[model samples]
Target chain A: MNWMRTEMERPGQREQFQDALLRGDRPAVEEMIRQELADYPYWRDELLGELTEQYLEGAVPFSQLTVLAEAAAALAEHLPPVAVCGSLEGNPGDTGRNFIQMLFRAWGVPTLDLGADVPADHFLDAVSGQGIRFVIAAAFSADDAGAAMLLHQKAMERGIRDQFDLLICGAKLTEETGKKLQLACMDHRAAAVARWVVQTWKNR
Target chain B: MEKQMIFPANRFALVPDRDEVFAWLQCDAGPCRAAFEREWVPALQLLEETMTPVAVCAQRNANALTVFLTIGKETEKRVSALFQEERYILGSLLNTLCDEMLFQMDSKLANILQRELVSEHLYMAERLEPRVHLSPETLQADFGSLQSMVPFARVTTSGVLYPAKSMLYRIVLTGESRTVSALHDCARCDQADCLYRNRKHESLREKEKLPERELKESTKRRKRLVWREEIGIPVLLSSNASVDDNSEVSRFMDYFKLADPNDAAYGALSDRVHLLTC
Candidate 1:
């Protein structure tokens, strides 16, 4: 096995903090991120996101993942709380990462984890109880979209449809379903969606 | 009886690259501008010392194909020891490290399977791990099937593989011969939006030398056909003159029990296959 591995290809660090993050040297990574966030918010956000992807791919260790989460949490401190949940039917190899919540953190948004296989009533509760404005629904399989649609209909029934933004993400969600629910069917890339949300939130 | 093969120590034993492990550990390579490497040695040593790779492969013709690989129970035993000693960080890192260690064996394991498997047009598309590509029940049954093959391994009532590190890779086969590729597993993974996902856009003409006409054959009717083994759906691309897809789409969708035509599942079916006439 050793012989099969060629010269170890060590990648160059894109920023001062990345090498520290990868080593799971959280204190150093945090210090560097704290410094960068003072001026280079975009740089800090993008790099942390890039590293989280590596973690998801199993390239990095658990410690590195924690570093990424902590760093993202720093960026997200000023943002309002949001809600997150999805079916248990997808991302089976997730290894307890609960990455959508992490991704919400990465987007610099705090989240309330409603737990798995959550129903429409649970989402409505997060909205009403938490005064949450954005509800991210994940549908790994198309069938999982049903819960989000139900949530939307319930929101409308409660006369609160205009109060919150409903986004359905995951690989199999379609515009047709989004249109029917009058929801934003989105790509699962958290960075882009996060950017849009931040701008919208600021304006609102 | 199905052919069951056990890998010898040499066949299964592997040491993954120290650099890979180090980089993954996020160690320093300062002059090369890397993280400090020494910090990771104890952990890697713990993993290398503890893991004993054992593998068993079995398949029934056309029905099922599986290769079961596990770092013997000792690896997890040591991890549990670390946890009991309140070395939770090390324990967690060890757990993740074992997965990295196990999955790095994917290529060698696939090679072993290829050597033993007798086939014609059938070729493995990718390794589909349970829970990732399959449901718990499907994996439960797959494990039950393996009970007779890898008797040393065990499966819980809930379909969790035993030895904690044990992994079952289902051999996914496409109907036609594909260019045997070293395509990274990420390339084939269905998570199109995964930050780590890699997509290969090589032309069919370049990769397979498939004559465009033959692969995109339209039955004497002028509608073109596109197919993918994973989707098991035929995307019939008809121009303004022809229908949206083959007449078989509705029946096939029903047969597959797919959600709906407007669903992302069908969109994925279209995306996975190329538009031939274009």
Candidate 2:
């Protein structure tokens, strides 16, 4: 029913939108996204994807990053809640996990933001204690990887691994690491992860 | 707990340059720039009206120098009273600005040391090794000796060195040339939350002169500087090794005199002893 969604549905428009974001066309991106939001309030995944790409490319400043995240969170108000956590130790500056949370919120997915330096037990408590079904865990440093492994080990110890879906992301998180931990490795692309979350929720 | 000695305030003098402090405020002005600008004038006026600069004496031991410092008592009282009355955000801003001014005063003191004593390096263990270096208890224990140095500042019964905005630091004098050993290695330190480490990493990356694509690709695997644990000079003590429970107990006992349980002060002394030991 939304014209902007219909326009975005046109072939290559999504790519153009992504290109605009990549080129750092803030005004154009803001105007188009705001217009799109007026009718297709749930059209957050695509925008999140573009923003994520820009962030990964090192085009977004920290202040602008927060603004983008807040915008995404605003759109995500109608979605079911999820839980996301950054590394227990500080993430390397390159890690975009915080932005990924913004992308999650943009997809109308309510998120419990367990901030950086979270302990393993805290992550487990958020899952089993709060009855959260899906978790997005991110790590950026060697210490962060250790913390993530500890979280997984604790979850396994408590026999609650089967109770929730754990999705891992970050530069340090490889496919081998994901396999070792028995968790899905969400690709670095925020839009792809956002879409996956939407599809998974629909299937559920 | 070694006994502390406090020298008279006449032994040292600290004069803060308003311009240098303003320059530092501007340099550190990032996200807080607007707030800093809005508060700077009023804060400066308040400081001019209420503040008194005071320096505590220093002790020189061969190659080491220990200096204690604090902004005078009246200013601390005024600031605390203001903080209690003001909104949380504004109070925090004022507090930070005052701390910055005090830090500027400390910098001036360091400069004076360099000029008078021919010392080139000044080090605060807190700033250098935030996680593992000198603990507050050790500083407080050492501050006992220097407590009488500043008449206005007091060491709380719990061994907290007060005039909350205070600094205790050591100086390094290298004759003829100023060459400090590069001891901080970000990759080696367990303090992942340190902003200094993050800034160093960013600076190192900038110095690499790599193209964007190459920089991105190489950042993950780039070799990191590792800290060497060897000490070049015997003068600098290992900050990590300086403080222990046994020493803390000895110091606390010396400060409070907790020798006999049957003494009239036994109950209060026992409570303090328990708190210190625990």
For model 2, the stretches where C-alpha displacement exceeds 4 angstroms are A1-43, A58-64, A86-100, A115-119, A129-131, A137-141, A144-147, A165-180, A186-204, B1-177, B181-278
Clashing residue pairs in candidate 2 (N, C-alpha, C atoms within 3 angstroms): A76-A108, A88-A117, B1-B250, B1-B251, B4-B145, B5-B145
lDDT of 1 by residue, A52-153 (tens): 566546564434544454444444554447654443232222223244555465555666655445667777777887788877665554445556677788
Give stretches of model 1 more than 4 Å off: A1-80, A85-100, A106-108, A115-121, A139-143, A146-163, A170-172, B1-11, B18-103, B114-278
Which candidate number has the best lDDT?
1
Q: Interface RMSD (Å), each candidate?
A: 7.9, 13.7
List each candidate's DockQ score.
0.09, 0.02
Task: For model 2, state the Cα shift of residue B119 in Å.
Answer: 5.0
**Whole-model Cα lDDT of every candidate shown, in order:** 0.53, 0.48
What would the per-residue lDDT of candidate 2 be over residues A19-45, giving only the tens digit for each residue? 443333435555666555344343445
What are the root-mean-square deviations of the candidates from the true structure over C-alphas?
Answer: 12.3, 14.4
lDDT of 1 by residue, B66-103 (tens): 66777777777676565334343455456657766776
